[model samples]
Target chain A: MLDTIRRLVDEQGRLAVAAEAIGDNADLYATGLTSFAAVQLMLALEETFDVEFPDRMLNRRSFSSIASIAGCLHELKEAA
Target chain B: MCQACDSFLDRLFAKGVLHETGVDGLYGRGQAFEAVIEGMDRLITRLAEGDHAEVIRFPPGMNRALFEKSGYMKNFPQLAGTVHSFAGSEKDHLALLDNIHNGGDWTGGQGATDIVLTPAACYPLYPIVARRGQLAPEGGLFDIQSYCFRHEPSKDPARMQMFRMREFVRIGLPEQAASFRESWLERARGFAETLELPHHIDVANDPFFGRAGRMMASSQREQALKFELLVPIESTENPTACQSFNYHQDHFGELWGIKTASGETAHTACVGFGMERLALALFKHHGIDTNGWPTSVRAALSL
Candidate 1:
């Protein structure tokens, strides 16, 4: 999970600093993660866990961080 | 204009249109509206078949900073809508209110917030996809549709402040991107043909970064790259661009760390249909009384 967060941070470059400033659960959208980038992350998550994230789970909060994403994955897996 | 087209336009105008703030004269009822809706319904039914199972809906708005990073503001600064905040003392507020009441210039000292209306439906999907790891060999696809907003302030119903966009996106290898886009082109063409709408396809280029956008636009004409599905709804002279197929090589993947199962950068492509524009096109072609329309076409759209 940390690896995933680190990778996302790396991919974001300067915006990752903004994410760190506001803490983990901070609104990543506010920090600088564009809608385009957010979608890319969602696609990556689906590929990683081989899970299909339901329409309800696709939102800013779900993609907020590594921890939030992992939590979503856990829920999706258990529901399945 | 046909009588049916006029009635449809009247009905649409009768219903008060809700438009985004600062964007006026861009939407309303017309033959274009009817045609666009009909066309969109047909396209949705045909595309919502096998392999395009998942139906995803995205937020109508987007993050402002993200837009800045995506170069939307830089590329189309004229069409960008910024979210802003008012942080002033009581006296400042009162003064501003007075300015407004007195018909004075009130556009001053507005601090920008970190949010913006989503310009495109597919943009918000990228970050969501990137959160997961690389895709497996076969790749993945998503069907997303949303109400997208743009700041084009044209009275032409075709250039709306807010409009519907349905997109089929694929993330995988380069070959997969090409194949996905090519398949969509065929499907879109067939779908349009069913509606008996005159359409054509051509290659297109994205408004690239910096000085390159001008060169790219010129080159688009030279190469006939970007194909637009044009229909004469708003103006007979200028056909509206209702749909487009875009191939974003590794640009998005590189920006968001999208990778294939093999750990290589993935290619992305999307086929988008402008639901509103298509609807308008349909209304223009077919009369307002959809009940009298062909049974098969009506059944296909579930109308």
Candidate 2:
């Protein structure tokens, strides 16, 4: 899941550096994943993972870092 | 006309559209500037005559209590400018004078007032209309304008600390407000075409504050509540938003207790034009000479 998430972040995050180059706990915002690009990444995530991010989970903290996103996806997977 | 772009301010200075008053963001608008600005205003007035919006002109400063109630501070505390003054004893006045004479900071003794510089043209109207209870069955529309102040000091002529905002607001049901925005969106495009400025409308959000604000901005964009008509002013790569269309889905209605004729919270939308910024764009694009502008634009603006 992490690898797949990392791949999506790499493809859709529009970050300056590769996703694999960043640590799993590195802050995405700090790496220049802008608010504008976040939506694209989000849409790509929903498409790739087949999960809709609820409005409550659509916040900076939920996407703060790869670990946080993985945690959120794990919760969603469990809920499903 | 100045050939190089860096001398844009110099050109404005020569044309008397912008006058430097030794302040970074505060400057005087001369005849040329006012001519185009007021010309555009009159054009809008004629165009908006059909709407029959109640015209309300507010003082630049608003009541501090209302300002707080609007929660502008929560989202944009950094940009808000609060008026403060020195109210003190004779000795304190003497001390203030001494501090100023000695080049000290006398502003520290100043205190906040009931007034706050108007940040947006629509803030005061919501509560005022809300206090009147339920709206008419036909809903309400307002034509409001004010000199708004934001504490943004910059070298860019497009970004001013104080500027005028001409806005038309719609207060009513969801479908009505949405339609109002939709029509105005088209009208805005028409106005841009008439003015002969190269522009585009894009989904946008307010420059919210902090991480929470980041989320708010995203959600706002995701919901497509805000749109800005961006015109290339200072740079072609990054254009300035000369006009904005926003639909606040019951944010102000809930905060101000405004309701529609049906007794539900009113949905609100507004279209605002950054008067000076548009003029700046014209000057940048059409050169300082208004007469030299394309005849179609001149005829459209009736300049």
Candidate 3:
């Protein structure tokens, strides 16, 4: 799941650095993932993972890093 | 707000500083109120003279096509107010009048016009500058003032449906835009001191509309894209946002094809002064009568 998340970040996240350059817990925003790009990343994650992020998970923290996004996806899968 | 703060609106109306227009957030300003607003506008103009900014004044409405391209409805559909007109024939007009006379929905016949109310003072400037092609080496600086509209209506006099905004817009590189907004943060504090208005600056976000908007607004705050200079007018705890400095990173430029001298997408920034709110703040903090305002404040405004 972490690898897949990293792949998605590399594909969708418009970060200044490659997803492989940072750890799973690295701050995506601090690495220049813009707000608009985050929206694109969220949409891409939903499509790729077949899970919809609820309003409760729609926040900066939810997309702060690959690890956080994986954690949010795990929670969503559990709820499903 | 508290009960005491509610009385401030009543006192303004009673003192004839603002005339109630049978609407919650709409009011007519009396002569003294207009004078104060004019004085504040003059002070803003005087402070911005050093920048040699190009002054552009726009009407209350803007081209609907440009507005749609700006993507305002995507984020703030709730606050948009578009103009609609009765574009039907004479027979349709008669039917509309009959419906109105019979207490029916006459507005169903009204179609959307090509114009929408200007949401902010600088919304109209970008396309005009974009049409002019590339900016000068130093980039574009504009002084704009306009009557802007929002749909929110309330008893809080500071939150008006229609109000005037005086803004200085900067279009250039990211650093240039950031520095322009940064300078205003300092200049605004100085203006507040000269006017004797107690104020504070804080990271702020627009009231973005929905669930998706919540994330956008959070990201905006996290990135420090917007800031507000707040003053206590209706509520001490909440305080009114009398001025805002926003750094819109390439948003307007990308939408309008605005380009810097080096050909990169231009970043934009603006510092907007809520003209009516500032006047109300002065009235609330000082007194309703401008004649009785503090000596230093009066001198600063030349009132």
| Docking quality level of the chain pair in candidate 1 | incorrect
Model 1 segments more than 4 A misplaced = A1-80, B1-46, B205-211, B219-225
Candidates' RMSD to native: 16.6, 10.0, 3.1
Once fitted onto the true fold, the runs of candidate 3 whose alpha carbons sit more than 4 angstroms away are A1-33, A43-56, B1-6
The sequence of per-residue lDDT tens digits that candidate 2 reaches over residues B1-303 is 436754777777776778998877799999878888988999899879899999999999999999998989877888999999888889999999999999999998999988999999999899899888899988999999999998888888999999999999999999889999999999999899888899999999897775446677876887699999999998999999999999998778878988888789899999999998999999889988888989987877778
Q: Choose the strongest candidate by lDDT.
A: 3
Q: Which stretch of 10 consecutive residues in model 3 chain B shows the poorest summed lDDT?
A: B1-10
Per model, kept true contacts as a fraction are: 0.00, 0.22, 0.70
**Number of clashing residue pairs, candidate 1:** 54
Report the candidate with higher DockQ, 1 versus 3: 3
- Per-residue lDDT over B1-303 for candidate 1, one digit per residue giving the tens place of the 0 to 100 score: 344555444444543322224445345444534544755655575666777545788777777766666756645666667777788889989988999999996678678888787888888877778888888798879888887887776756566877788888899999998888888778878787777777776655554433324433543444343567777886767777778887777767887888999999998988888887776676566654565666766665656
Sorted on lDDT, best first, the list reads 3, 2, 1
The DockQ ranking, best first, is: 3, 2, 1
DockQ of each candidate relative to the true complex = 0.01, 0.12, 0.60
Clashing pairs for model 3 are: none
Ranking by TM-score: 3, 2, 1
